[model samples]
Target: MSFKGEQHPGVQAPTPDSQGFRLNHTMLRIKDPEKALAFYTRVFGMQVMRRLDFDEMGFSLYFLAKLDENEQVPEEQGERTVWTFRQRGLLELTHNWGTETQADFAYHDGNAEPQGFGHICFSVPDLEAAEAWFDANEVEFVKRSDQGKMKDVVFVKDVDGYWIEVVQADRLSALGD
Candidate 1:
């Protein structure tokens, strides 16, 4: 099907490719790695699949994933690196050295005047329960599930002010063909 603004005669719909490709991960620059890591792990129940520190480059890459209940992360660096790449829906947090020390340091969360990148999303089993948990934990909310036009949808801000969309997984399944 053609999308809006793609009515040009020369433009053709994209055909599915047979390549064995998949979305690896999405990276977000974080001012404070410690705080960001805690927020993601404690609030979202994500674990650190792998951590690569580039001391020479003055930065670090942290790969996090929400693993299955029985899944265990590899202890070896090599094994962890390989395993991290194989997982889907991973979140990469990049931390530049010394940024955490600066009192006035902050990253562009892409929600200001010149907005570019929007937000990342998470599907939970229960929207109301998740919303209550967030509220109890004192997490900042940009928009609640019952707010505005979008019912049963939530938008929360991370420590770095990045927006995260939360929705009910059951609701998603209901909308699927």
Candidate 2:
């Protein structure tokens, strides 16, 4: 059966030649690195897999990932860079230097006006527990799971006002259909 639209005869999906093609990371610019790092690490339990500082460019890049409990990150910079690039589903936070000192500094969260980039999402094992944790931590909620028509999903705002969709991993199949 044709899905979405009719497919032309003798046409097939194009496949990449290489084997290890994976999404490296999604980057988000933040006003404060410390606040962004704290939220991703303390709230979501993601680790700082690697950090790259550009003193000349006046910026820093922090790559965070939800690694396995026992997975050890390489200590050396070169090894860690390779290891980080190998991992999938990474979040890269870019922090420009000296923005933290400005009281009115803010990044365009991509939710207002133009609204180009939507939001990043996380699938949790326990939706209720995650929601409870978010509430306990005083995270700003754009839409709670129970509040919206899609009752199984929740959207929360980060320190930089970026929307993060949180959903139950087990219910993903049902949600997809």
Candidate 3:
């Protein structure tokens, strides 16, 4: 699969296919880029791998990752500080200058109505341990369960109310095979 003249990763060049296109990042507008970055880094244990500035647009983008989930960082201060990008998954935190506001969406607080889009999902190896962490940390979990062959799933909200889905990767496989 390819698209827009960009060759698909496993397909021949010079032509794009729609099926080859994949998600690069999920962009979210935040009230404070610095605060959001810190929250994600400290809570999820993700590190800022790269940042790009759009001076003309007055916005900035950041890339983050888990310490051991990717390749070794060239110069990390400690074991837990060596986050890297193992795959294409990324969170794009954008800050628009002088807005002091966040767009109404899954990341924002807009009553109990989910507004269609509601959460970002992450896979963890252990359901019990992850749920315990959320409970001990006082994070509000929307749901939790072990669905037999489907995999154990848990949902939690961060400090700013962004919902996160934690599940076993095996759950995704069960749906197909």
lDDT of each: 0.90, 0.91, 0.66
What TM-score against the true fold does each predicted structure earn? 0.87, 0.89, 0.63
Ranking by TM-score: 2, 1, 3
Question: Which consecutive 10 residues in model 1 have the weakest lDDT in total?
Answer: 1-10
Instruction: For candidate 2, write residues 1-35 as lDDT tens digits.
Output: 45645478986664667556888999999998999
Clash pairs, candidate 3, are 1-20, 2-16, 2-17, 3-16, 3-17
Name the candidate, 2 or 3, with the larger TM-score value: 2
Decoy 2 TM-score against native:
0.89
Model 1 / residue 29 / CA error / Å: 0.6
Best by TM-score: 2
In model 1, the Cα lDDT at residue 147 comes to: 97
Rate residue 99 of model 3 by lDDT: 52
Highest-lDDT candidate: 2
Better of 1 and 2 by lDDT: 2
Against the true structure, candidate 3 reaches a TM-score of: 0.63
Candidate order by decreasing lDDT: 2, 1, 3
